[model samples]
Target chain A: MDNIEKLKLTCLHDLHVALGAKMSPFAGYDMPIEYAAGIIGEHNAVRNACGVFDVSHMGEIGITGEDAEFFVNRIFTNDVTNAPDGQCFYGMMLNDEGGVVDDLLVYKRGHNDYLFVVNASNITKDEQWILRQADGYRLCLEFMSEEMSELALQGPEAERVLEEVVGIPGADLAFYTFKEIDRDGDTVIVSRTGYTGEDGFEIYGSHPFIRQVWQALMESGRATPCGLGCRDTLRFEVGLPLYGNELADDITPLEAGLGIFVKLDKPDLVGGEPLRRHKSEGGPRRKLVGLEIQDRAIARHGCEVLSPDGEVIGKVTTGYRGISTDRSICMALIDARYAKTGTGLSVKVRKKTFPAVVVPKKFYKKSYKA
Target chain B: MIRYSKTHEYIRVEGQKGYIGISDYAQKQLGNVVYVDMPDMGDELEKGEDFGAIESVKAASDLIAPVSGEVVEVNVALTENPRLVNVDPMANWIIAVDIADMGDLDDLMNQEEYDIYCLSESH
Candidate 1:
């Protein structure tokens, strides 16, 4: 009864239902939120062992032509030039006013060929934005989201599972690298990248190929079938930002604590001048920080953040009980003066105010390979 | 006898005291129960009002009072193992209350009436 609008399904929808997954509407897709193992178990499975996710709802766009690399570096905040082939970079696309358009991954397949992976909810808007900015650039852009299906095999045992179960050769892939492999007269692109902080692999293939890999991994019983529910928790525990919650149309990477990915010294790019000015002057008016609540109440997204004197400052972007660390923590964007480490703050959870303390935004340490 | 409310809470009367908890349908919908915030003893609960919150893995829902009463006891067992609600909602009553008045029972629905209400709400 939650969703009245018609929902879209992925290639693994029937398989999720057959596995007794709890279905919910997320980013216009009827996706599985969790399976029979539940969120906590699946989350632990990824942290301790291996887990698989159907990330086909993500958007993929391909650009190829004479001026493809130039067009990409013109709009993206990162310096894509001089990077080695098969290297992937994380950066943001911003509007002229410095507000974020989307945070995406840029995969360099060759000198003039690149693959851009974006969030599912911002597909149409991102496509339109790219087209609008392609006035004088000579590049052929294609939205390949529908033709590509993605699966994230994440955990400590990911490499072993990929080799033993799926019969895929991917042990040599370093972090942030990918290669196209030939299998049975078809091509499958495997990347050593993941949303979770654990060492993992993301496999992109055709629908039938993805379905077969999912079945093979499930039958092997070495990889747990995870859902979108744990995906949020795992990413949040490592202090990664979700699009709508942390980086939105109104939030800039500088204000969201993602300035490292923004190369302000680049010759030119969208929102370059404004971001450069902000970087040179410490930061923007508001800054992001971590809050450890002294109480058990979970301060969820949009919860009002206030100073100790009860003055309204900012709001919480993401909050949860850290399943890995066993602490009640959250990320909030507050006035720069109140964002200092060890600054005392309070959050309004429902009808009561709870005391909280400012801390480093990284709640849990990342355990990535390389 | 037992009765249910439109908000999915059920109450079982024993003499002048009543036991209150959510129905099985609600627990199933809420998914895994992680924490349950309950009211303290000696707190006054008004009819058709929220007393505390029950948080599941997905979201939090308010626990509404089925009848006006004064809370006499709480389910201390749920504080340590809240998943007991998901295991057996009816057996794990959340709180015990002293009935303020007998007329409040008329406003609630019986078992058969509640079953029909759930069916209609689902469609």
Candidate 2:
């Protein structure tokens, strides 16, 4: 018997292949890394104009019941208690030891109704973890990952594209909020949220509806068909955290430099006690910090970070030659003593070690129209 | 005459010196070259040794030497614009090296043989 696990395909897989995109395996899916114009072209298109991404591989779960809001607040670090409908909260689901299970966005669709958007690679693990936590809650959990498809129309021109090209009015929606629209017979959810740190919208619907929207956007010629290669770069330029790199099963949200999302004032949560204690005890032993390398060599994930005296202090989580900022930068988890801004450090890139300095994590300023 | 290595590097022989660069297939595989790290002049390179690195937007790749040689000149053009390799890998040789041993050429594949080798490796 062939034991090789088959990779999953999203609704836009055929279209991506037709466009001559460089395809690679990502999170168990055969996804596009970039197209003929390459990563730089696609990246510039998003920064200056607009780009559309097939983010359908992202997992979605629906929770509806009398205790839906209460249950979500218990598992999530952000305090979403009594949040207005259509509002979205970005936070993490933590384990008992305060490590991250996953970072996700929770949408309060209505009273007693919620939706969760999670990382594509963590679909099975997130489902099992959420189900285990749902043992006592009076809520109905529905796994809609396979049935749903998503598209992110991002950049400065996203609103105009949505209104004129896709025939959807998205200017009325506030940042981090969403609205459900009835298109013909299918209900499509459109949110003014994105990971690219731009003014954009995330549209969710059935596979057919998503394919139709993708085709229409591509035909319009205003939105560039971007792939995951530029998507990672765009997010990295603005200092966003990727799950497996920045946050992991053993990396806590506080340690990942995302303490702002973990609401400490709320009632007890799944990992609340430990997180609160960790905070009260003067923060984590190791912290994530940004490093600016003096040389042009790109520091990548798993590269060792060393102190000025040559001690192995930490490891790089993510790094790149910032397309927008035009500098070699990276984020690393290192000892608290070496994480202070302006501290001297160095990174081992293959055969040589390059000098670096601790800097602010936000490499590029975000241009979100909030 | 030109020769290729299994690792996708190529050498175009001229007298006792040869111009070296990655193969066209290798450049296409490594999308969007952003930077190239090359060795200084007079540095010695052994057969199948990593002489430098080539980085793209997503990842980096090592540039392996197909034959033992001494670095005569580093392509300074690549330092300013590395994408020249992606545009034309043959014309934009990465380095010029003095051949240390003529027998090293016997181990490399010629154009026709290398073409067939690349086809077989792709599958």
Candidate 3:
């Protein structure tokens, strides 16, 4: 069968087609890349106003039982023990070798119930990993990816749209917190969390409820219908690590510059020993850094980074001519010695080389609500 | 006369010189052109050969030559504002070249043929 025949479609697929969106296959799903307004417009809308993304393709897993909290803390890098109900922690699940299996968000719904939102592409792998790690624990896991649909209403005007347009009371939510509300017999989870650096709410509910909210927001004309195209650009600008790009199976979170999230002090944490050793040994051999290209040519993924003497030392993970910043920047994994800010390097884009300097990975500062 | 390649590039023939740019449909598909990588003046481009590339916010595409020619001038304005191609792709020709052979034009499609070709591909 052809790729399209095997691809999955989200609940918003028909709506996206009706809106003249450019559809493409992403993570085994037929996803909209952009609407007629284009990536730049959609991107700017989220930066300056409001834009909503159909994030239904993301995987949702639920864990509950007497040992849910302990099971989660053992598998997750972030400390969630005794975390208050409705608190969410963002961290990674690492393999025994300390390489990242997936970066995910664990929401502490209550004393023993947790919700996990993971990348769309790593659903199967993550489910199997979670199941394998759940052995000998008194916990029940539910993969609710197909049963749920999610929308991310993001930007400066996101909270206003959530209140006025979607008619959801999300203004009280602090950053990284979530609450479940019963709306017309359906449980809708609204969280003040998003991939974009903007102040946003990620609403999760049944397909029908999500479709209703999407229609309400679209009909009200308060939020632009965004796609995965700008979603990537926005996240990249904020220095967020995409799983396959910045944090891969071979790349550790410590090397990806996410040491703060990895709680090496947490007792019996999976992969904690190696991570401690890695930290105690000064750090990983390679490190992720930001490179600001001096030329107009875009430095794309896998482009080689070279020293001034022309020795290859690194490769670009994610690069873009940033929409908000208007500067060509990229995140690259380079030799730790050359990962220092202000270090001069060059990137080979196809046939030409451009001068670049190591800078902070965050090309744009986040405007998340305090 | 304007002739089109299956790759969506168009060559506008005028005397012995030809101006080349991507079609309007191509620009809409590309969306928000960020950079256009063009060959320098006097660079030789062969028929069906890729001479340069075009980048949008999400992805990049190669600019394939429809016919052989020597680059006489590159669109310098695109260096400053590549979105000019998105605004008016035909008006903002990417390069002007001296035709290597007028016979090369015979291999391209006309307006009607290219439109139908695009329609079939879109479906």
| TM-score computed on alpha carbons, candidate 3 | 0.98
Across B1-120, the per-residue lDDT of candidate 2 in tens digits comes to 999999999999999999999999999889888889899999999998899999999999999998898999999999888889999999999999999998999989999999999899
lDDT of 3 at A174: 97
Per-residue lDDT tens digits for candidate 2, residues A131-170, read 9999988999999999999999999999999999999999
Chain B TM-score in each of the candidates? 0.97, 0.97, 0.98
Report lDDT (Cα) of residue B40, candidate 2. Answer: 90
lDDT of each: 0.90, 0.92, 0.94
Which residues of candidate 1, in runs, are more than 4 Å off? Answer: A1-5, B112-123
Clashes of each: 0, 0, 0
TM-score of chain A of each: 0.98, 0.98, 0.99
Q: Model 1: per-residue lDDT, tens digit, B3-79? A: 99988989999989999999998887777787777899999999988998887765678999999999999999998
| Candidate 3, superposed: residue stretches over 4 Å from native | none
Selected candidate, larger lDDT, 2 vs 3 = 3
Query: Candidate 2 regions off by >4 Å?
Result: A1-5, B120-123
Worst 10 residues of 3 chain A by lDDT: A1-10
